[model samples]
Target chain A: MSGAVLLSLAGCALALLGGLFASSPLSARRYRAAAALAAALIVGGVWWVADPRGDFGHPITAEAVDANGAPVSTVLVLQRDGGRRQVRRLPLRRPVDGAEYALWAALLLGLLGGGLQYRTRDVGPRWLAPALPAAGAGAAAVMFARMGGLESGEAGVRAWLARFEVGAVQSFTVPDLPWSAQPEGTVALGVAAAVAALALASALWTTPRSGGERLIPIGAALAAAAVIWRMIEVGGLPWRPAEGALWAVAGLLAVAGLERSSALRASTLVGAALALAAVALGA
Target chain B: MPRLPRMRGPWATAWAVVASPWTPWALGLWVAAGAALGLVSEPGQHPASGLVLQLPAALLVFALVARDLGASTARLRWAALYAAGLATALVGGWLAGGEAGMAEVGGARPTESYTRTIAGRSAAAHLGAQLGATLSADGAALTLAMKEHHVGEAVLPLDGVREAHIGRWALHLVDVAPGDEPAYARLKLTPRGGGDPIERAVRTGSGAALEDGTQIAVLRLSPDFGRALGPAAQIQVDWEGGSATAWHFVDSPDLDARVGAAPWAIELVEVATEPRLVLGVRRDGPIGVALAGFGVMIAALLGLVFAGRREGRS
Candidate 1:
């Protein structure tokens, strides 16, 4: 639901559409148009996610009341406000449903592979093309999974996430808020299952003849599998930007290299530049 | 036309120089230096300053990348990739580190952070009026800093206050008493930049006493709020105790303790140096220690990735 996620998905979709329509110049043009659309979606998503709206609320002061106008227990939500330090409370949403995430992730991978087929001159066979998209989507999903709902119910997740810690990254374990608890817990499990199912289905359905045909889709599927496993292994975890950047760079590199034509080459350049620019805005 | 390998022109030589593998090494060195400087610089100043530094670092990295990749690919691809990397680093850093100077205050410790809100105005109120000081591990020593000095009578509530030691020139602590007990414990410390208003306030033993010089006050808590200052003159006390303990250091030693009721069992002792106020809560809990440790790591990693990618790709 974040802009980065959406942009990444749109990128994959654009790439896939480009692949599907590779046979004709007209189709390639249409696919290129789709790529542009995907880029826009990504930018919009990034802008929205990095919203700077400030929410100011009254500070919580711990007050204890006795049985009859007497003090029983005292708690002070010591609010420290300085011109320098500003703390905001970001109520964590539930871990998105794992099933839904997997489904989307799979779709994204397929789209990425498809896009590569259209752009690349000889991407082997029809079946092999989905691999690139699979890789992109899988990698992105795995990375995305690392972040879902870690902030749910926690007061200081944002602050903590902003800074670096050693060892096991400790997320803020909040006294579970009512709204986020059930959905977060259930969605994670469901999404995990759904992704597993999607991966399995894609694996069974797609078949290609030559090694070149298998290369793109197989690589993509493998990437997706890696992502799925990472998500599950990390307990629906998220990746820090440092680590996540690797995937982004890799995705950019893979797509850029898949084609040699002036148009595909230009599209890759534009896409990569846009992605980088998007990264710079820190949206 | 001889067509001797395109005559091995100067263009090829220029391209080789520009896109040479050594570009990564040169870029790597610059990126490393920039990151090291950014981390080592004084906290709270680094975010903006570091950002400024990043431009040069990104450019260098991109330059090396463009040189190497552009020759193989078209001029446009080279330019595009370089631009992308630069943009990504900037956006990523901003998104992660916001403007509030959190990244500047980079290290984490298991201590509560405190800020004083001064209500009144005094001479120390103008430019160079603010003091930004930090305490050492002992919670007894301090790094005193003066900023934009101005004078004013300020109603400063020192949150996360644990203890205090006032210099003679500025302020002095009169007494610290437990909410449940009245016996006043006197903090002992040497006075600097001498003045007598603090001694007079201590001698009168009146909570209403106000010192003429800088006012400094230190507070104590019993893991709970037994007694604390309320709005205006009201003293709020909780029979059930549970407040985090720490101290606040002020410039003036004179404090208006009459804001609260008197406790019964407290002792007064005079020592050589004024007890320095421990500014933040001493938590040292798991989360605190972990966060500080990780903060440094994450920052370093971000620098490495941005620097490394451009070089590696090129």
Candidate 2:
């Protein structure tokens, strides 16, 4: 099948395995490690596939002609194919200001804080923790997906999907986006880098004798920063249906990690109810 | 503290180095090597947008070193070294020709008439027009024509269209271009059963059986006239009019998006007229911001993982 489907299946399998093996203490550590690693890889892989640097081709070119069969000039050159360059003029007359960058920044920061709180070792009944984010994220994702579905009729969805395809399959090029260019080894190299970073983290944790208390803040900051940067790069809302679903999953996992029986029971009931509600409402 | 017996030789030296809190420097060196490789590969040839991408490695290295070295003076040195590493990356990106200028190009509605012509034989031209003006053809080949230019269509002798891209948008021709049996198809654009033309036009569907050498009129309706025809709205039939039936009736919208209700609302009718096509420049906002957004998402995800693992350790 498609690489995306394959990768996603692999990730789901890993997450499942992690959850399954989490019954034993020794296996719990392995479970967490596998889950985290798999989730992280999926996240990275999706982003890479969606934004393949080398595959982003430009839209408008310099040699483009107008409707009346005249050459198109006075537009920004975005891509160059052979000798023809795709170009489009700047400063469209009317603009749609949907959401500002500042808003996105705020949302990302909030997600980071929420994630931190949910993952914090001591806060709340352990079982209640992950469910909080999971429920909230899931609710938000479902709502956003509805909106996106409505807009599926518009060209926006197709264009967005085009970016993903173009990034993956090298042959695809968006003639309208003339400036699109792909980054060569970013994917393979990025994955390798991630693995190395994970290894390094493992080494650090294993090497230390005890007392992880002091390192928590630094780790938190790194996580926050990384999440922020990644959110920015992904260029969509955290509540965007696809990526937002991942966050929801993260939330659920966080709650599950808390390990409190009543909280787990309550969360399970609430989650099941929510799933049922979704199904009923959808039907 | 009681002194333990001294461990000697290569393994001891290696352990000393590994535990020496100088691992950050080693990590930094390794990071540099990775960056070097990334530069060499330069898969997509995307010029660097900003210093965002390199932050994860820097943060990871700095946090690791700072945690291992404690809050001592040595940690301060590591911080400075981390900054140096970042600076080196920025410089490397610059050397590799990554950064490009970001010019602001505001968004515009696709409600205006737009025309794009592709020159050279076997060349395809895509013009971003109002979504309303988009039409479908159900013949062996699909051809679109500009008012002034010759009406030409792709002469592919294929029956079914595997896929299609109109301007930046992908569309399904199955809706407008009937089943495989039709020899020719015509998409009409005139408003039906006139309301005040100033108000919304009741655009009902009208079909013209297309035969060889069949000519159709492409109407360039006004914004007021176009807005009346909403999504899936089509004209019922062509209205035979008075003296104004002359060429002057065809309206070309102003390119400025603000000047009209919608910039690309000029409709394409299926009847032949002196003024057949309304051609003009169709503009949309520059895509740099969107590109930047995609970049930000990627960098953030990577950073999150790095931070998550690093924090777990600390």
* Top DockQ prediction, candidate number: 2
User: What DockQ do the predictions score, one after another?
Assistant: 0.01, 0.03
| Candidate 2 structure quality by residue, lDDT tens digits, B193-217 | 2222221222212233223222223
Query: Per-residue lDDT tens digits of candidate 1, residues A1-283?
Result: 2333333333333333233233244334323333432333232323233222211121111111222322221112233333221212222222223333443444455455435544646356533543444343344335443543222223433433443332233222233222212221122222222322333333334322211211222222222233233222322122223113223322332233222333444333323423332332232
lDDT of 2 by residue, A56-91 (tens): 222211122323322222212233344332322221
* Model 1 global lDDT (CA atoms, 0 to 1): 0.30
User: What ranges in model 2 sit over 4 Å off?
Assistant: A1-6, A12-16, A23-121, A148-283, B1-45, B49-245, B248-314
What does candidate 1's lDDT look like per residue over B228-287, in tens digits? 221111111222232122231121233323221222111122111222232221111112
Clashes of each: 101, 77
lDDT of each: 0.30, 0.27
Residue A49 in model 1: shift from native, Å? 9.7
Stretches of model 1 off by over 4 angstroms after superposition: A1-93, A103-107, A110-261, A276-283, B1-11, B16-314
